[model samples]
Target: MPLRPVAALAAACTLALLGPSAAAAVALTPLPQSVRESEGSLALPGRFAIAWTGCREPMLERAAERFQRDLGRLTGVETFAAAGPRLEIACAAADPGALSLEAREAYRLQVTGEGVKLDADGPIGVLRGLATLRQLIETGPDGAAALPAVAIDDRPRFAWRGVTIDTARHFMSIETLRRQIDAMEQVKLNVLHLHLSDNEAFRVESRRYPRLHEVAGHGQFYTQAQIRDLIAYAADRGVRVVPEFDVPGHARAMTLAYPELASNPAGAPAAGAQVLNPASEAAYRFVTRLFDEMAGLFPDAYFHIGGDEVGDDAWAGDPQVEALMKTEGLTTKAQVEAHFHRRIHQALTRRGKIVVGWEEIIDTGTLPRDIVVQAWRTSNATARATALGHRTIVSAGYYLDLLNTAQFHYGFDPLDTSAAGMSPADADAARKLHPLVGRFVTDGVVVQPMAPLTPEQEALVLGGEAPIWAELVTDEMLDNRLWPRAAALAERFWSPREVRDTGDMYARLAVQQDRLRRLGLQDQAARARMASRLAPGASEPLLVLLDLVGPVRNMAHDKRVPAAIAGKKIVQNLTAMADAAPVDSLAARAFLARAERAASGEAAARAAVRADFEVWNANHRRVVAIAQDHPAVREALPISADIAEMAAVGLLALDALETGKPLAPETAARAKVVLDRADAFEAASARPIFSFFGKRPPADLIIMVTPGVRRLVEAAGG
Candidate 1:
């Protein structure tokens, strides 16, 4: 019943060559460091064979199987494992030893008419090459599988390209975690930082303390076996799984199960007492044992003991903690926090694991140089940590949970800014005053040029991560929230600094988006399903509205809806058009540009603009009818009507522009009134359900026709 690999390869090659323009180059994501295109191409069959020379590692063999399965899934071809020269995989040397950071992940992939070859230093490099090969496979002009002839030498620019997923806020299933890991591997992200515990829940099962899972986790937690499985899954794809157990603060879940470990006992109303009892010996013992068990599950040497946001009141009202602080001669709450971090650092050190924590730990001034600080709150944290002789990872601008556009995250570079302009006297004085002084320069013309990081400081900057905090995220929204954008972040972490063209990045992203969907990412599909739920009788209007609008950015959703309502379900308060769309305003702007060109005498562009406006104009009636029977549709009816009115007014302005007639004073005034009304409608619709909360800010609405209509009206003196 087994299909021969040679036959599959031959069939794929024959089909690919039959298509026209089979040698066209495919735009690769995370563009290679160096690539040279040739004049031929290799046609891939539905079932292809891989020929290995000196690649015997089990990881490499597993990678080959993955590649075979992925290719079959992508091309609708049934691939088989066999030995042949159709696709040759090999190592550069005879002894391609163990994989590590020191081992080169750089790979050279060469494709020709005869076949394709992938060469790497180790199994890790081979996996990287395979990912590239998967991305390179494209359907030719005649719809057959093909790969353009090219030679690509590629390696990551940073070693710690990562994504931190917070499961504590929202317990994600193991299957979901695996899917995310698969997605991360597609973009070649190297690390998966699992935030395993927080105030809401302790997401990992503790066999040593079974109550931690049964009571603290609310019956939703990953078993130790699941954790190990996830680690192996990540390892096979060249990703390190790092576990984080937040301590001192964000410890309500832990304290719920073991009240004795809490600084303030159950039923006690003490200020700033919602943290682990640093003064309690039992607390330290519990943490040490739990961390040891969790660390043993993850093979990676790095462990994250969350040391962020330990409030000033944390130990203020606790008698025991106050006594301990007094005994230790600690004057400020920060000093107490420092003491707790130092103890944990010492414990982790004894276990032979490197500790990684948030920026608060760096402020402690007690953590050893070996600890890694993750800078999330400020731009200069990475530079500050590195300046102090500690390695650092930047995550401030890379918080994907903020819902910013991909371009915003891509523009943030970990190594771009430094403390080079300050004088030696000022620098030293500033260091004494604050840790971030040398990391960020003040905004203004300076007497001296800004200095780049010293070679040593640069060396200490390990890399960066995109942290996806799951406060408002749900299982269904995870794929849409992470991908396409994470791919962009991946490029930022992998490609050379000079690769900063946002336009080019988006073009490749369009292709990658479809590829991700084909690979089982439900970003687009989820939106469609949500739209159907909103307007089952007529979902097109809802879909059209979403296509032009996106979710408000900068945590605006948090402001517009109550936390209790939003937190209960992902789609509870997400019926607005923007909730299902991405935040990039580029597409609307592009359409406006076309509309402007249409005004300059392009008939087809003019027709296109008119057709789109007509659709929006007609959508209002359909939405109104649907809302009559559908409560969900009614919820978004106000914005829907406003969009329709904007489109109708846009059509009027377009007519005047095409007629080359100046608008009368009265007509112009009426046009302005219509525009103002549309704006007011948008503002009113965005108000929170609880109006007593205060005056709501105007919604971050992206009306596609606004620019085009404004241009037409201004030309007509309206």
Candidate 2:
């Protein structure tokens, strides 16, 4: 927020004014707090430029430079210093302080031909304005660049809008992480929670405990200098980087590096080897020193000490741990973990930091009120944590690796008491699955009811985060694993609670993805890259297949990770169909929308629906050929043939509709049998075709288009 203006750019590249684009309603993501548009548009030319006034904060300059680059890249305008129509940025009232908890993010903008003004309370607010402004750029008539004539007043709904990236398992390069930060900044999201350590590896370099980096990291970790550079990079963009150092539990990597730090250094770490030596005084001292060093690197006030998943009998074989537990009245692992948390809390708090823990830390009720608990188990966890006066963040319904649709996560609000808008089937499944992450579940955890929080408790509830654990993701696959979906979820975090229209969110999401792609995110490109890897010159056919399939939902069900794929070479699991597929099939959703119209007797819609079936009926052969060549993708081969059969069924149903007659008894029975064979009982569920796999199989992709075909068949009276 402090003044640090950059040297203005004067690039000679042409802005390529492609004239005015088709006039359409604005489709802003996280939709603005208030939007009022009049009846005109502002035309921009190759000479279009930006000028600053009121304040020249370095953050503001950086925002301007980004705007200049993105505007040109997105619109082919090549923005630079010029004379004609320009964007005037005013920060006279901007809070001139370091970007942090107290920073003001409110902004108001007026766009018109006379002058376009971006006014904000701080540099961060200006960044939000510029982001919104970038989304507004469109090709007007004559293929010229233009912006809508509108007034927008916007501010974030939550103080913390973030995503937690797990880098310890699969190390993402600094570029990958930096790209994430850039995407976050564009969406007005303010936090980047880095899960830097886990059982698989420690991700941050440690000068104090060198082996934690050398041996524990397995030759892959962020250097101290890289961490500092990342921190500075995020700071400049008004994004804070919060570090997570799992303690007690998820400390296997650290123990492997420093044996003396394990709970049973005297014996081989067997029971509770995944955790620290809770009974050892040396463990406490080590935590204190390590946290102090970590605190110096991550300047944010909050720190995440993983206090989840410690087994109750983790100390079973160790007599020292047993004697200590008996002496300390620690009846359960939660209590033992709390004992560890208390020391970690004191250690981090001493270094001028507030401690954050997974929801499990709240179970023992021993930690102070200041701890922040990420309630991922259930929304009820938020209520429970806040009931105990502990600040909490909601993350239960926003697990990115769950492979849920953006609309699904978009509909899940942090303050909800009931599963209002959820399909009865999915809501029921969630209740059964809630708080139970299979092996990831901590012992005796409650499947909390969706209870509403009180006003006081709601005040204690912070924002939520979308966690993308890297076990099933690699550097190339991470973007598609996140983006476009994260953009919609970001809306949930930053926009008003009333902005719950899944339909509108998706429409705007398409535009937001294009902007994100222009800003260099690989979410839309990763699929193509993966497809080409699977099929050299014919990736297009695979892409057609990818559009209609998705990963099997639920981490417990994802077989492409270490749980099923064994060995550190889990990264090789990328060749699975899910690796190339999206979290959900947008193409399938669109097909269904058209099928709904076709069901209503729309001729054009029916024809379009038939064309889609034609594509599916034949696309499988190419996929089958590629899958035959790649054993990792062989699972897709059978699934591909099944789609062809379903497509043939759809064509049969369309023939019935065209003839204005129901299928003959024998024909109807045959069609029903085919559907019954491939259908996942409930046609709307993910993986509607692959229900035949053993509970968990590496070939884990769902045929999303099957449901649409089912709808068509039903409409044809089959």
Give TM-scores for every candidate, taking all chains together and pairing residue i with residue i: 0.83, 0.88
In model 1, the runs with Cα more than 4 Å from the true position are 1-25, 76-85, 93-100, 265-273, 418-452, 559-579, 583-609, 649-718
TM-score of 2: 0.88
Clashes of 1: 3
Local accuracy of candidate 2 as per-residue lDDT tens digits, 418-527? 43223335345444552332334332233445557889988887888989988778888888888878898899998878776665566567667777888899866778
lDDT of 1 by residue, 1-718 (tens): 2222322322333333222322443656777777766676677755456788865677778878888777756665443232323888887653333323455678999888888889987777888898889888877656667777778888888888899999987778888888888877788888899998888888888889887889879889998888888888888888888889999888888887877788874348433235888888888999999888877777788999998877656676778877887899988888888889888888888888999999778776666999998877655666667878998887867888877778778887877563212344543543453333323323210123335678998888778899988876767667777877888888888887777766556656666666777777877787788778777867877777766665655455664243333454233454445566665544554465556656665666677778878888787788788778777667566566666766666677677778887776776776687666655433432321222132332244445455666676676557
lDDT of each: 0.71, 0.74
Q: In model 2, what is the error at residue 115, expressed in angstroms? A: 2.8
Q: Model 1 reaches what TM-score against the true structure?
A: 0.83
Q: What is the alpha-carbon lDDT for the whole of candidate 2?
A: 0.74
**What RMSD does model 2 have?**
6.8
